[model samples]
Target: MTTKLPAAVRDRALQIAHHEMGHYVMARALGFVTGGVTLTVTMDLRHQGGACITLVRPISSIEAMKEHLEARMMVLLAGAMAQTFPSKPSAAKRVDKPKATAILKGEQGAEQDYAKIRELQHLLRNIAYPDTDPVSCERIAAQLKAMTDRVWDRTQKIVEDQAEAIAELAGALVDGMVIVEQWGRAADTYEVMYTGPMLERLRAVQAIPSLCVWTDSCGDAVQHWK
Candidate 1:
């Protein structure tokens, strides 16, 4: 059997969702509104790895710039922490050991049927090592705690109000679209289009995987190869 993930994972895409959502909500709580919650969307129904919510921090007055670089970095790394978080909300159960075993054993069961064949293109490939190991999830969470706590009520309210629309937007983005702010303060408003290189070589790795890599690697996987 391919790794089924937990059936519960289907409920929220993946465990890290709340973490990604936390950044989205907390950014607003911090009042950095260069643009209100910007990024593309996804609806593929796969776990989207962990970056389900793509939140761009607002750029305060450019003339007299004050940078929350640290804050934003913390926010950027928050979802991964959330995904690996051991809390009740994030970790539903222990690792799917049985499925993980099958995956390692070459079972290629139904659960992994789709992923196995798809990953064939990447056989023997090694993902880039994370620069920061021994990283603390709580440290990341601590940086975000203030914003999340500050805007907890408001953010959760926004989530509840727009849950359906958000889901649809994610689906639309997966189909082919970019979710940029129309102007400003247009909550969840997005314009779909096709632009950019549509295929740009990564600075890290010059090889670009066409449209397939475009979606899968967040356009960054090829950076090392470049």
Candidate 2:
């Protein structure tokens, strides 16, 4: 009564699901609230990509802003880092930093994430040094590279430590998508899969309180865990 998806189609969808779950898991683990996660599948079912809706609170102080930016950088980097894991949990047990970094660097899916990271770094530099005069492009490039390296190392560590949780979440995502056709939107051009089950799994994994409330403000999601 139903057509079976081709192996390539299913594998592409699975990869997108894993990538989005990576972001969602890291956001919740870092005490950020997510509106939801989405997996978009074309009608032809050949191309797929996903998005994770992460929310942050507004910050008033420079110190708060710096911390917020750094945390967000970690969240952005987490998606690519998580994608480095083997689809099989058994093979994923080993944490290979070089492999993970290589994947992060080479992943075209992560280009936008890396762009956002650079944008945040620029904001961080300007806000932290508002009075400083403009430096040569070379110096600025070097400084940003140093900042990226520092944050990348930190994000890598977090991803490594959370490998078990990430694997669990990614596995759930791949399993959940088998019924994705049931959730296709009226638009028909693209299908958006629901993330309620994924969120529940994340909350359970992190033992986060069920006191979540929806708001554009950041206090509850950022401070409640602290």
Candidate 3:
């Protein structure tokens, strides 16, 4: 039997789903092979916020690796972005005004994501502009945000397109009724408890062609490999 989830738990799960799904969808759209996504609940205070995991393919070269790093950073940022601007009002409606204000005041994973982006900037600078001074870091930060902005629309569409799937998965996680079926080293399948029309809706969304398109800025920087 599936356990009933409290209002807070349900909301938290949906937040995690949107965040993680952002990574998963973008990674796939960028032609990076993904190992699937997983959502889990935790009692650990540090992780009580919830966990969403998306496994991606390994990078092959330094130049190619940099592109992958940038993509990953954007994916990471997508989670917090989704939280800040949820696709559906219901996802965050239950949050109290004060708590909602707090969420808006601070992003979900800003610190970690920013750190990763900074690290990626350092690596890219070393390769392309090693002689630059500290001020260059500021420029790199701007460039990173610009890159993220370029694809923001696509990310939003993914979140919106799969909103129901995310909610379903979130509900499953909250109920502690998720079933995992590993599929070799390629992908991992998650079976949620809920069924019926919602599943059909998710399949319909998945059937739609990808709306992701590379902006000129990112297109020039990250070569199309697939």
Candidate 4:
């Protein structure tokens, strides 16, 4: 198929790619095992979407659990933060937090992501405070919101810092050379494994210097899952 396409189509594809990469990049940085990232956009607009599947290892300690939850939230928030990228490269560093936060608060495409974050938040809250008393529950809710906001801020900063990396990966996707979506797969099915050279290229585009440290910390958790 010819790579040439309308400008609108290309823009949408890049946007979707960036959104999924936001999650994929953050997840990898946090040592979460990613199944892969997929982007599908056909003439049928109803089926246009992308995903980055991540797997967090089971934790033996409460501390690990908390860290994992916070990491997951950051990963989730990264998607929206990426989508809000300014069209001008020079403005990437100056991304307005208020506008980006608005997108995260209730972006149309991010409902599912926000929902997932909420569920994770709920889990974290329950783990942190098991008490069912009304007063304790209210206080815990406030504390949890604070924690969530902190994670959101951290995620936004990471996205801002990695703006170039995210754009590079998205461009690779738009070029249809490195990572191309499987048009033959069913629209609803979104499972792709980024292995071999493809995975290497993806890593090359996004330099996560801390990946080693993160992996070392959670490497044991992976073995436990198997």
The prediction achieving the highest lDDT against the true structure is 4
For candidate 3, list the clashing residue pairs, or say none: none
- By the TM-score metric, which is better: model 1 or model 2? 2
lDDT of 2 by residue, 63-92 (tens): 767777877887787777777666655774
lDDT of each: 0.31, 0.62, 0.47, 0.63
State the displacement of the C-alpha of residue 41, model 4, in Å, after optimal TM-score superposition: 2.4
lDDT of 1 by residue, 1-226 (tens): 2123234433333233433333443333333332222232233332322222233544465311222332343333322222232334332322233443343344422233224422421221111113323366665445445433432233233334333333332332233323344555553322232122221121211121111101222245332111
Please state the error at residue 113 of candidate 1 in Å.
29
Candidate 1 local lDDT, residue 129: 18
**Winner by lDDT between candidate 4 and candidate 1:** 4
* Residue 149 Cα positional deviation in candidate 1, in Å, after optimal superposition: 21
Highest TM-score among the candidates is held by which one?
4
- State the lDDT at 12 in candidate 3: 57
Q: Can you give the lDDT of residue 198 in candidate 2?
A: 46
Report the error of model 3 at residue 54, Å. 7.6
Report the Cα lDDT for candidate 2: 0.62
* Candidate 4 wrong stretches, greater than 4 Å: 43-47, 56-58, 93-106, 135-138, 177-197, 202-206, 211-226
Q: lDDT (0-100) at residue 225 of candidate 3? A: 23
Error of 4 at 216 (Å): 14
All candidates' TM-scores? Answer: 0.27, 0.72, 0.54, 0.74
Clashes of each: 15, 1, 0, 0
